[model samples]
Target: MNYWLIKSEPSTYSWDDLVKLGSDHWDGVRNFKARNNIKAMKVGDLCLFYHSVNEKSIVGIAKVVKEYYKDPTTDDHRWYVMDVEPVRKLKRPITLAEVKAEPRLNDMQLVKYSRLSVQSVKEDEFGIILEMSEQ
Candidate 1:
């Protein structure tokens, strides 16, 4: 399965919010690239739930429950969304500082395209981040 990282402002939609809701549509992505990334997601793909802005950390894991479909939040046909459910909270959040410092994660899209809300993650990078969170 393909791995991904999806960012949200904790104040707007925290990890706790997702856990409480059970499963919800991941929408409101306006960026073309990010929207494409969302479209690329398939059911059962794993995603890292990241708190962007102030927190700037990956706080939990989520799994795609449904593939892309027309975004109910908007009338624009170009927009799309998917369903995701919280898998589990990490043992500890892996901060941006920690991610940037790790040489192995140097090539990550999280480092390369810091502003991208939805980004692809290499399998090895996904494994490394999970390892870091445990430590």
Candidate 2:
């Protein structure tokens, strides 16, 4: 299965907010690249739940429950969303600093495209992040 990273501002929608709802459609993606990433998602794909802005850390793991569909919150047909549910909160959040320090993650999109809200993660990068979280 493909691995991904989805970011949200805690003030807007925190990891706790998703956990409380059980599952929710990830919406409000305005960028074309981010939108495509959402569209590419499939049911069962895993995502890293990241707290962007101030936190700048991956706080939990999530799984895609449903594939892309018309965004209900918008009338624009170009926009889409996918349903995701919290898999589990990480024992420790992996901070941006930690990821930057790791040479293995140097080529990760999260490092190169820091502003991208939705990103594709290589399997090795995904595994490394999980390992860092375990520490």
Candidate 3:
């Protein structure tokens, strides 16, 4: 399955909020690139839940339960959203500094496009982050 990283500000919609809801529509993405990425998602894809702004870390995991659909928040026709099921929280969050310091993760979109809200993650990158969280 494809892997992705999605960001949300902890002060707004944090990982803890996701865990409480269990599953919810991933909406409010306004960036063109991010919007495209959300639309490209498929059911069963794994998502690394990243908290942006102050949190600045991967706090949890989620699984795409529903594919792309029209976003209710937007009046535009092309904008879309997805449904994601909360998977689990990482006991230790992998910070941005930790990620940037890892030589093996140099090619990650999270490293290359730091401002991106939605990004693709390679298998090795996913595995490395998972291993780091374990540590």
Candidate 4:
């Protein structure tokens, strides 16, 4: 079970939007690296839902419900998307400031590739973030 972090701007699509919809296709990823990350996802993989830009925090958990498929929003075949469902809202959001200050999360892709919309997370990093969110 690979762990991942996916970002969305709060104004465009927030964690609450996902929870209300129940589940939805994760689309609009234009970066080659991010698209590849989406393609790499498998059903049942867990993902952290992050609100980028202003909020800059991980607000909830989600699970992949479907594997990669053609991105319906785009005409290009190179892009792809996957379906994800909200697992639960975190007891407390893990902010970027908090993440940056934590030595355990120093090596996280979320910190290394700040602009990446979809990024992989190490198991230990995922565990640490989960533990932090509960506090």
Candidate 5:
């Protein structure tokens, strides 16, 4: 399955909020690249639920439960969203600082595209991040 990193500002929509809701449509993407990443998602794909803004860390895991559909929050037909449900919270959040310090993660999109709200994660990168969380 494909892996992704999905960011949300804790104040607006934290990992806790997602855990509480059980499942929610991931929407509000405005950038074309980020939109395309959303469109690429498939059912059973895993996503690292990142808390951006003040808390720049991956706090939880989420699974794609549904494929792309027209974004319900907007009237624009160009945008789409997918349903995701919380899988589990990380043993410990993996901070941006930690990721940047690791040489293996230097080429990661999270390091290269800091401003991206949604980004692809290579399987190795995904495994590395998961390992980091355990420590």
Candidate 6:
């Protein structure tokens, strides 16, 4: 399964909110590239739930529970969304600052494309982040 990082501002929607809901539609992605990534998602894919802006960290893991479908809010239907369920909470959230300081994670998209809402996480990078969070 493909692995990705999905960003949401804590003030807008925190990790706690997702854990409370169990599963919910991930929508309101206005960027074309982010929307394309959402469209590419399939059931069972894993996502790193990252709190952007103030929190600036990877707080939890989530699994895509449903594949992409037309977003009801848009009449033209260019946008799509998927349902995701929280899988696990990190022992403690790993900060973006810590990620950037690690030389092993220098190549990660999380560092290179800081503003991208949805980005791929390389297998090695994913393992490294999980390892770091465990510390």
Name the 10 consecutive residues with the lowest summed lDDT in model 2: 126-135
lDDT per residue as tens, model 3, 1-135: 999999999999999888888899998888899988998899999999999999799988899999999999989977889999898888799999999999999999999998998888988999999999999
Candidate 1: which pairs clash?
A: none
lDDT of 3: 0.92
lDDT of 3 at 46: 95
lDDT of each: 0.96, 0.96, 0.92, 0.96, 0.95, 0.90
State how far residue 30 of model 5 sits from its true place (Å).
0.4
Candidate 6 TM-score over all chains jointly: 0.95
Name the lDDT value of residue 27 in candidate 6. 80
TM-score of 5: 0.98
Model 1: weakest 10-residue lDDT segment is 23-32
RMSD vs true structure, all candidates: 0.5, 0.6, 0.8, 0.5, 0.6, 1.1
Q: Write the per-residue lDDT of candidate 2 for residues 8-104, one digit (tens) a residue.
A: 9999999999999999999998889999999999999999999999999999999999999998999999999999999999999999999999999
Pairwise lDDT winner, candidates 1 and 6:
1
Candidate 1 residues 19-103, lDDT tens each? 9999999988999999999999999999999999999999999999999999999999999999999999999999999999999
* Candidate 5 structure quality by residue, lDDT tens digits, 22-110: 99999999989999999999999999999998989999999999999999999999999999999999999999999999999999999
Give the clashing residue pairs of candidate 6, or none.
none
Q: List the candidates' TM-scores in order.
A: 0.98, 0.98, 0.97, 0.99, 0.98, 0.95
> Highest lDDT: which candidate?
4
Candidate 4 wrong stretches, greater than 4 Å: none
For candidate 6, what's the RMSD? 1.1
Q: How big is the positional error of residue 128 in model 5, measured in Å on the Cα after superposition?
A: 0.6
Which TM-score value belongs to model 4?
0.99
lDDT of candidate 6 at residue 4, scale 0 to 100: 89
